[model samples]
Target: MADLSIDFCGIKSPNPFWLASAPPTDKAYNVVRAFEAGWGGVVWKTLGEDPPAVNVSSRYSAHYGKNREVIGFNNIELITDRSLEINLREITQVKKDWPDRAMIVSLMLPCEEAPWAAILPLVEATGADGIELNFGCPHGMPERGMGAAVGQVPEYVQMVTAWCKKHTRLPVIVKLTPNITDVRHPARAALAGGADAVSLINTVNSITHLDLDRMVAYPIVGEASTHGGYCGSAVKPIALNMVAEIARDPMTASLPISGIGGIGNWRDAAEFIALGAGCVQVCTAAMLHGFRIVEEMKDGLSRWMDTQGYADIAAFSRKAVRNTTDWKYLDMNYQVIAHIDQDKCIKCGKCYVACEDTSHQAIARAVDEAGTRRFEVIREECVGCNLCEITCPVDSCITMVPQESGKPYMNWTQDPRNPRAEPAPAAAVVEQAGA
Candidate 1:
């Protein structure tokens, strides 16, 4: 059995799975139910100073797949609409009641020292584990000088982080927005501002789809629609890249990360952890399938960990960072050619068509003695691009098989084709050129 426990920037949880600061954690009722359903922690929905944020009806719109599964979720919803006092009181009671579960309060306010300074003490008084500066929300709050409005600007990210660090005794985790051209700038800014950790990535700015009849985007309000924050499985690849960038960067390598975006299963969570997330947060998955999904997540992760010989999360945490590198550093000599399994091949010409028309002409089609259609890999022409494998409908029908080239490992920098390749011994250069 593997232990899923994690100590994220001093806030301990039984497992690495936590509910993100979204509708799922909006109130004590929702949070309590999540905890009861086996969540290890919850970031209370973004809270603001009193006269709370007003939300609109029909605030959510989802992008669905062919089977009607949510591929992505978009929202124009704002932060918590409950009063600050009520939120604080509830946070206090919930933290006291569930001392074992992590209680990190997410807060957003006008970018000012006064507002931040005032709210820090009130939230700290709730006995919460920590405070996550909600600088990542992309919709309703940004217009008010909060959320991505502040996060997109490195200066604001640093200043607000400094203010929160100055006023609060709790660990300040800066929630970063992904809207910026470069995510590292804001992450570095957070570290400079004395942030304890950073969580990302906030929802992307997107309008899922437009209603052709009404000529308006989704989540239509009357006859108008504005771009909202986009999340869910579709954004996982983007999120993973960002997390890997931060984890491998020299500037913020030591910073703790709470991974958010498109995490629905144990594999997704494991990928984030391997890329250096201290914990993983879930929102869209919970909304789509309910909190009980965490049970599957926990069980699947634990079982997989056992098979991998990992005793705890830390055992595999950030394990992939070393392997994540620039394209220039990749071994040019390493090669793998596609192999077609005749037994498993479904005789589908999708792979053949895809490779012949769009990619390298690496697959040959013919008829066998029985006049049955057959497809085989043209290994000599295969560039090891994996296009055939990806297009194949049957699993494992096309597998990439590594060849025994017996060639020395060489990166682009050392390759002879590179005009600025590093100088090598005459013999070595000749050998490489011949190879």
Candidate 2:
């Protein structure tokens, strides 16, 4: 078996899986149960200053699939609703109970150094391992001149991170906000401010649905509603791109990254690690299913590593970054064309309609004798771009097959693979050679 253990910014975990700060990690009771279920560590739900913060009712809304299950989630919930003293006590207890697990406290308060200075010692005295500055909460804390308020301005990000570094002996990880235009700007700020690691990305603004009768937004509790942060499996690609941006940037490339947003299972975690995240964070998956999902995540990741011959997490960490260069560095010679199997076709004509109306108009359709819709690929007119394959609903109904002989090479006219190659009507060369 390959080892899934990871040492991220001096904090070691049995695996690279850590629960993001959300409802699941709200207290010690929930975290202890999660640790037992195979979660490696947890960033406790963001704790606020004394007296704590309050949230609203029907605070969460969901976007559903055909099955009517939640695919995307929106939340107006703020920081820890519990008092500081109770949270500090629970952190102390949870750390003492699970010494092997990473207990990193998440905190959000007023953007003053004095507030940070006051809270750091209290959290440290609880025997917690480290602290993650919650500068990424997009919804609640911004009104108070915190969370993304501190995140959007690079100077504030650097200043708050530096304050945490000065006040606490624990490792400081600056959690980044994705609401900005460039992810690298705040990432560079964190590294400059002496942060040991950085985690991303807090959710983006969203409005899931609207009520027709009342003409109000979804989960309508009153006369009005505000946009909440959007998250789930749908946002993973966006998160992956942002993570790669920071990892590939020369200024902040070496700093450890904690990948957050839309991580659902082991494969998602591995992809994040490959893209240069030191560890992975989960929130929506746990919220959608339960803590038991962690068991499958850990098992699945370990099994994949064994099959790949990776001895440990470090062996494959940041492996994908090497191949993720800018667009100009990509291989221009790669080419492909679309293919459709007549025998396997259900004759839906969906591909033809989509292509003709919205795409390249490369697919032609006609009704056969059996009154079934059939689609044909136009050889000369086809651009071979594969847009039809993407829009097609049927499985294995459309495929993109590369053609090597019938066209001019768009990116590479000549290659070592086919030196002294003659142009197309390539079939003529074959016939002449046979004679």
Candidate 3:
């Protein structure tokens, strides 16, 4: 069997799957159940100083597909609402009871040094594994001079991270917000501040939709609604790109990553791990399908590892990082054309309509030798854009086949079409005999 255990930023867990700081990890009740369900760890819901924050009613908005599956979820909910002492007492007892499981407390406070200094010792006394600086909540927290408000500023990120590192012995994983223009700046700042690791991406600022009749957005409280933190499967691509950026950056290449956002299964966890995440966190998935989902995550990942001959998580972690590269570095000589399988086609005409109206008229109606009406690819006009494949309702009916082109590798940096490209050797182009 493959070992699912991981030691992330000096915090050891039975597996890499941990619950991100959210309602799922808000209290001891949820945390205890999650642990019982086989979760390796939980980042306790974000803790602030003395008095807890109050939340509003109907603090959720969701984007759904035609099938009514939630494609994206948004939330305006704030952090822990209970008192500080109560949270601390619960955290301390929970950690003591579940000593084998990793317990990292998430914390957010003012920009000054005093509040952070005051909270670090209290959290450390809980016997928790580490602390995660909650710099990414994009909703109500920002208005209070916390959350994304602090994350968007790199200097503050560095300063606050430094303060936590100075005051606490526990390893610090800085949770980052995705609301900023350049994610790398704050990542580098976290590294500069001596952060042990970084977790991302915090929810995005989004308004689900406008209620046409009411002239208000969804998750409306009374007669109004506000933009909340956006998450769920839709944010996976954005989160993956951000994680890859930090992982592949020379400045923060060695920085430990705890991937968060849109992770719903073991495949998602493997993707993050392959892209250089030492561990992965979950929130939306757990919220959508209770904590038991971790069972599949743990089993599926282990089975996948066993099949791939990976003895442990480290065996294949960051395996794909080297392959992720810039668009400028992509080969320009390689070419592919779309091929349609007539036998599997349902005659929906969706692909043909899409190609004829919106795409390059690459697909057309044809009559086969068997007197069957079918859609065929126009090789001469085809651009291999994959738009037809994307529009096709029938899976595997449209495929992109690579053409035989024995041309030498060439990239944008040396392409003749690039006017600003540096002068270099002319690309070797082996043309097809008859086009």
Candidate 4:
């Protein structure tokens, strides 16, 4: 079996799965339960200074699928509503009990250095492994100029990270906000400020749904509502893109990433690791299911790794980063055409409808002698868009088979059709030699 253990920025864990800083890790009870259920670590819910954050009533809403399955979750909830002393005491005892499990405390405070200076020693005294700077909370905390407000600005991210680095010896992991235009800027800022690692993406600002009768948004409070943080399986693509952006950036490439957002299973976790996350953080998954979900996550990841001949997490980590690239670099000469398996076709006409109506009229419909409908792909007209494959209900019924285009590898940048295309390498070399 492949080793699942990871040393994320010097914090060792038996496995790569850690509960994110949310309601799930808000207190000792939840953390202990998660540990007992096989979670390798937990980032205790974000804590503030004395006089804890006041949370609102009806703090959650959900966006559901056709069968009413939760696709996304929204929350207006603030940071830990529990007092500082109680949280600290519980964290101290919990760490003492589960000595092996990673116990990273999440902290949010005013952008001032004094507040950070005062709180660092208290948290470090609790024997927590490290601290995660909660700069990504999008809703309630931002109104106080603490969470996303600070994260949205690169300067503030650097300033507060530097303050924490100055005040504490513990490793600082800056949790980044996804609400920004570009995630790499904040990641670079964290690196510049001396952060050991960075975690993302904090929830996206969203309004899940609205009530038709009352004309109010979801999780309504007295016929009124506001935008909250959106998370869950729906946000995985967004999170993956951000993680890849930071991973591929030259300045922040070496910074460790703790991938968060919409990770619900082993496959999801594996994708994040392949994109260069040192470890992964779970919240909505554990909330919707239970801590026991980690069992399947660990087992599935381990089994898959074994099949791939990977000896450890590092063997496959960041393996996909190099393959991810700009569209301009893609091979325009590479071609593929959809082939429908006659034995497996259900004759649903979904593929034909999808291709003929929205995409290219690549699929042809015919009626046989027996008056049966048949669909076939016109080889010449097919652009290999995969619309037919995507609309097909049956798996493996339509496969896109690559064709030999008989052309050397060429990208858009070197194509003659492009008005601004760069000269071919041979031409450029000849021009340079003549010059």
Across residues 169-190, which tens digit of lDDT does each residue of candidate 2 receive? 9999899988899999999999
lDDT comparing candidate 4 with the true structure:
0.94
lDDT of candidate 1 over 25-101, digit per residue (tens): 98999999999999999999999988998988789999999989899999999999999999999999999999999
Worst 10 residues of 1 by lDDT: 426-435
Please identify which of the two predictions, 2 or 3, would achieve the higher lDDT against the true structure.
3
The numbered model that scores best in lDDT is 4
**TM-scores, each model vs. reference:** 0.96, 0.90, 0.95, 0.97
**Among all windows of ten consecutive residues in candidate 3, which has the lowest summed lDDT?**
426-435
What Cα-based lDDT does every candidate model obtain? Answer: 0.93, 0.86, 0.92, 0.94
Each prediction's total of clashing residue pairs, residues at least 3 apart in sequence or on different chains, is 0, 0, 0, 0
- Cα displacement (angstroms), candidate 1, residue 37, comes to 0.8
Ranking of models by lDDT: 4, 1, 3, 2
Q: How accurate is candidate 1 locally (lDDT)?
A: 0.93
The residue pairs that clash in candidate 3, if any, are: none
Q: How would you encode candidate 3's per-residue C-alpha lDDT over 1-435 as one tens digit per residue?
A: 999998998999999999999999988999999999999999999999867999899888899988889899999999999899999999999999999899999999999999999989999998999999999998898898999999999999999999999999999999999999989999999999999999999999999998999999989999999999999999999999999989888899999999998999999999999998999999999998999999999999999999999999999998888778777667788889999887889888899899999989988888779977789999989988999999898889999999978987777877889998855554332111100
